[model samples]
Target: MVQGVDSVRQLFFGRDDAENDLTDGLLSSAVFRPNYAYREVLSGRKSLIIGRKGSGKSAICRRLAAPDGHPGACVLITPDDAAGDEIRRFELQGVTADTAKSLIWRYVLAVHAARHLALHVRAAHGRRSSRAVGALRAFLRANGESDDARLYDRLRRGARGLQSANLSLKAFGIEAALGVNGASEGARASRQLEVLEDGVADAFASLGCAKTHPPLLYLVDQLEQVWTVDADSHALVTGLLLAAKHITGRYGRAVRTALFIRADIYDTLNFSDVDKFHSDEIRITWSHDGLRDVALARARASLGAELTAEQLWGRVFPPSVRGEPTAEYLFGRALPRPRDAIQFLNACRSVADERGGPVITEEDVLAATERFSRWKLQDLAKEYLVNHPFLRALFAMFENSGYFVTREVIETRFEVRRQALHENFPAYTDSLTPEGVIHVLYEAGFLGVWRGGDVVYAGGIQAPPGPGEDEFHVHPCFRPALNSLGTERMTVQQGALLRSDVDGACERLRRLLDRAPLPAPTHTETLGEVLSIETEALRRKTQGRPPTSAQLRNVATHFQTLADTLRQSGHVSHPVTRRLLDEARSLTRTAGGAIGSGQGSNSEG
Candidate 1:
């Protein structure tokens, strides 16, 4: 039986979040697309997976921890708020803040490795454990690392151990205090951590785990839950990077570490060693094809049927949305990532279900677009809230403006709000300048720079907007929420040709709707739908080709209807209203006449 809208909505798309999606949801082994980033991590070549929020970092992390995941046992560490507080407050007197944090992380990793080794050595390598393995068990038991305590509790214990240099190293045969009495606190702490790590390494070596078994994988994820925009947070992340690198080399092939970090948080690190991890950094970016593949896979997984992409997209969902292929329209407007795609696809289905549909119609997708845009806009701000707390406040600068803007326009907009922004966020005034705001917005993917005939956003190896790049376009993902749909400022000459006059008329009507007040919701809705249809038809107009006589006539009919609707609304006879009415009626007559004479005219009367 063909799946109905209710089933498609309820079953076809999984939960928006991968965490929830993995448990009794659709993000199973069947639907998870093992993209480049996942492959890099799985191969142990990339330990730092950076991506924008909802870019599938956690999904990869969780997938690695699944039973069918990595060849080796996986330890997933997701710090909660309590654990974050402990790390943020941790400081050592004789070491840098980053070093102190690294030591703590090393302790955590070493303990996790030790625990894994103790169990593996007995379970797989036989119950007759080696002396080194026995020592790890003793050490874990003595220091309470053996308990299945929460991450916060473990961090608290490790923090206390490192702060006091009192980690029971007796298991490694050092029953008494260290002889380095005159050393700084940092040296003492480092020496103690080294002892524990050495013990863990010894166990790995003794059991030949490095040679006989796949490396134990440590997957640290969801640091954004604990992240803040402060010196401590910076140190916290920098420390983890250093620690992950350290243990990867220190434990040799016996252990591997991967940290799935949000790009916004990762980009904020500025320590001297930040550049060293370039080789290990794999940024997650989803292509249109990749997203489509994901959508198809998820749909198939949900239906438990071998549904082809065409059936899922063309049959289950409308074939096209607003004159573009449904897939293109959907993914193009979303930040290219799994989470955004999932949320949007599911939202369309939900809307369709509510409207009592067997399939997701164009109306459902259009309605979902606005809601999704609002969600993404708010999410974009929240995604960078730790680093760019003023992000939400900056949205007002783009709201109701054209989606396409030159650097000059943005600067002018920022200039008007610069003082207020500085006053509101004095700590961030340095980044509140026009140039600074542009760069920030560009990095956050809220804006894309026009370069080399394409709108390039962040990720995908695209360079940041340079000083010479004057043109910028608000990302489609955010345009609807900002009500900035007009593309008047776009450099259309760089693309295929467009019918300038009809396009202009459409733009004029949009501007009129934005400026002039209508009588009621009914009129506004009717006019909005008409304009939307006209825009879609225009989008379908072939590139580099003039509108045919039939197309012109169709447009003329739309304009005539628009003119009549405006007249009936009885809008105030203001300049904007009069110009809109005049433009619509004139275009109707001119286009209609051109078609009647079997000639096409792409001009306003």
Candidate 2:
């Protein structure tokens, strides 16, 4: 049966097992492996995990912390949760909670102490008899504390010890003791904080069997949440990450820490000092192919199906590939981000459930696509164009052009306006141009490029080509807004025909006629001259037949319409003189009878 059925609750619910364990679960489970990311972490490298929310960052963290066959190989910790616990347990030699805030140095020192303690515990194997443990005890005593001190006593607890103390920490109300103010006073406080951090690292080292085994791997998750809290929390989290980098670099043989962070927050944290953080430490992105494999593997696991990525794609979206499906086919025009693909499948599963079956059909997938497209567009509209007026105008123009505007068409409209009113406009009109507006729309996944050109529909925009492509298009949803803008600038007819009125057309024609400098007619002018030229040409074709009166009237009427249009639009420079002379002569020549034999045709005919 499909996972999510009966209720919307089930539809959105994800499997907890898939989240915690990597084997035999969701298709997404197999699709997402921490080994690649883990390898980087295990090598003492630092990197960023940039998937959107729910894209498996947390799952990857959990998996890395518990690699198969190496269950006791790594430590995973969240600073937000463990900070207060670490501080209180690693307070400076002469510090108390009241003066902890002043002892920033102790905090750093405590980290070292903590590291030493953790190493000691790992060496002792819970026996407290080894030389490392003895040396650590002596170090603690000499630095500030006595042998058999409570903190050292607790530090020796190890993984099982810490887990068992979970309730005790809660009962004693020491969980909140991990707060910033819990460390000791003065420069020693900095020392204490460092010691505390070191302790935590050492604890992790101990759990991962780092002392006698390979380097310990610790996965730090949810760094973004640090920024959401108060300033002190933010600083604490940043400090920890820096400390991890430092410790790993200085002690590569002993431990490694990999931090999984959101892409959006990576820059904000500003950990770019590669000399301090190491340039080789950062890994920021997962390629499209990598994400595709992740999605396919997860789907197979979730459905309990033994299928290759290709076969799995076929089962999920048979119509997309027809005979044999692939990840590219299943995702349609959308890029193969693991989260996007999984969410799509989830949406399809909802439709299938509503249809009373575990099976998802092509129709369901299409419906899901439509739903995602509309949702994506709404988000893009709000996020990108809600405030900028110029973008608003640009969007309006794009929409008016029926959503498939070429660069030339947009440039022409802008140029015409600029020439008419903004003659002093800057030269970089195209650079200051609103192409970015389209780009923003594209990035948000609302717009996509089509084969013929880019196209945005109710479903979403088609993907655009790389730079230097000939054509582009957009979604039709922009049509209404653009048409409205175009209507305001000039009437639809004016903009469409590139003329303000019939007068404008006539003025254009007059300009062309004047530029050619044709001779005026002997009695009338160019209008009559043109009519005579046409009549004579017709006569020549008809063996010297003259034009009929009916034909003459039709030709005259056409010219009069043109003159009237020109006059109305102020295109006729000498309208009154031209009208009086032309109208009178035309009336004086009114026909009284047929110009030819009853059965005869006119010369023009």
Candidate 3:
């Protein structure tokens, strides 16, 4: 069994088949073998393997190319093998606009030729004949007229002779083609490619013997890297797809190509006329179950013991009270893609390391979960702020409200602020305030729906499950970072002045109403006029009286109307007003006073 730093390092960092064997040995009996859409690919089909970075896409590809004890027959060609080297060569050649197109063409031709050589060596089993000779002759005849004709001819003849002597063309020719002997490199490469293609065709023809299998499978991985560096990489990919389709069709199932590509890149392709390509191919999506199985298989291989993926996961990270082990619970509500699971595990490991623990624990998982949630929230914030400015004002409201905010309270508070601002500075009549800002914050994940029938600031907190399997809560992960305008003294001063105004207004309105009783009126209009007169009289008599009892009632009715309007407009319901009304009713019942009789009494004070 492997042990210690070197072994662990090899298990984690080794890239080729040898390393893979160790990994498989370590994990074989556990449970997490990659469930690549292998059946479809092995059945001579094309597919895409899409996943984010570190999603194990590369690992899955490697597994398919080199399964345990299997002399991997597949030829894996990556963009790095072709474009990476080509880009440096172009820079060395002093690339310019005039030569860019030629450089691209050469790059594509080189990659295709390399792939051709690999296929030839795999199929030919070190044999050469008239077909290989004829292909070399044809290549020399065509390209020999170039400036490097003599060098080309010599390399071409040498490559053909190597094949004739039963040597692997790929093993013998690639280095010669790329050798520092600049004068002969291009010609030699072209000649090697010509012979390689002919050898491949001839080998396939021989495979038509009754004892031989009909088709050979070629697995290509990391095709997405081509397009990442170059906008025109799509053309190369399209060409490869078309060529594969052609060979598979012409050979009548004698040869197959299976390409592994990222799903997002595949989606970006123009597949409007899918029938133009092989439309009957199978498509496989790696789901949560598939990822879990891969992890389990890896674990089994590592431990050399029987263990299901779930069991392995539980061993690594047991469930916690704060979160369950459901797939959604582990990887959020979205589909648990391969990358997400791996990242979560990585995060758990990181937390464990930070806390000086050798094994990952449930607490580590929980902490990682919160970290992931906060990252998502930050992403949401960036998206909201960049795409929607109106949300900025809404976010500010929640930030300033100290956690608990209701829609009605926000609207009422904002409207009052807006009116005051309008009166003070008619030039700036906009209603941008803290209340309005809270709404924006809600959309940005800083606030979300809470169980208390109103919105609450998320604050990055996650709720641990309580007794009876309660739902999650808006657990604060970190302290809020919001602009708190004005000092404590300023806030206290403002509150004192506002309270004094309110008290003075209440006293003046009470005296005015006591002095001028409303005259009894039969019609609604006449009663309204009497109430309006009393309201005005109260306003004049009091130093800061809001209005008469009738006016206060009118204002309350207006607030209710506004709340209804906001609800109709799709704003969330406000619980603050309802609570205020409930409190008022309770106070009235306890005091043995009429419901509307205490309006002039400064009960709020």
Question: Which wins on TM-score, candidate 1 or candidate 2?
Answer: 1
lDDT of 3 by residue, 29-103 (tens): 223353445554544444544443344455555555655411334545555544533432331132232233232
* Better by TM-score, candidate 3 or 2: 2
lDDT for model 3, on a 0 to 1 scale?
Answer: 0.41
User: Candidates sorted by TM-score, descending order?
Assistant: 1, 2, 3
The parts of candidate 1 lying over 4 Å away from their true place are: 1-11, 486-605
lDDT score, candidate 3, position 247: 49
Compose the digit string of candidate 1's lDDT tens values, residues 1-605: 24543445454567777788888656567778999999999998898999988889989998888888898899999998999999999998888999999999998899988889888887767767889999999999999989888888999999888888888888899997553767887888899988988888888888888888789999999899888888998899899999999998899998999899988888778999887999989999889999999988888777777778878778888889879999999999998988899899888978887888767788999999999999999888877787888999999988886776767678878889888899999999889988899999999888998666577888878889888877777899999899876544443442323355567777776676666646568456756765775566565454322343334445655554544444555643544445544554554554444312112223433
Each candidate structure's TM-score, on Cα atoms with residue i matched to residue i, is 0.80, 0.49, 0.45
Each candidate: RMSD to true structure?
13.8, 16.9, 16.3
For residues 1-605, write the lDDT of model 2, one tens digit per residue.
Answer: 22332222233323433343444333232444554655554454444444433445666676665545233345555544344344333333453432332233223323344444545564645544444334344434434433333432333332122222221122112333232443333343343334444444444444444556665555667654434423344344455555555566444455555667653344334434425544544433345476666555555545554546544445444436334343454454343344555555666668767776545667676566556555443434543331222333344345434443444454555554454222332432443343543454454443444333224322212344445432344542232333422433333332333212222323433455555433354223545544554544344334422223333344435445545444454545554325423542352244222222111222121
Candidate 3 lands at a TM-score of 0.45
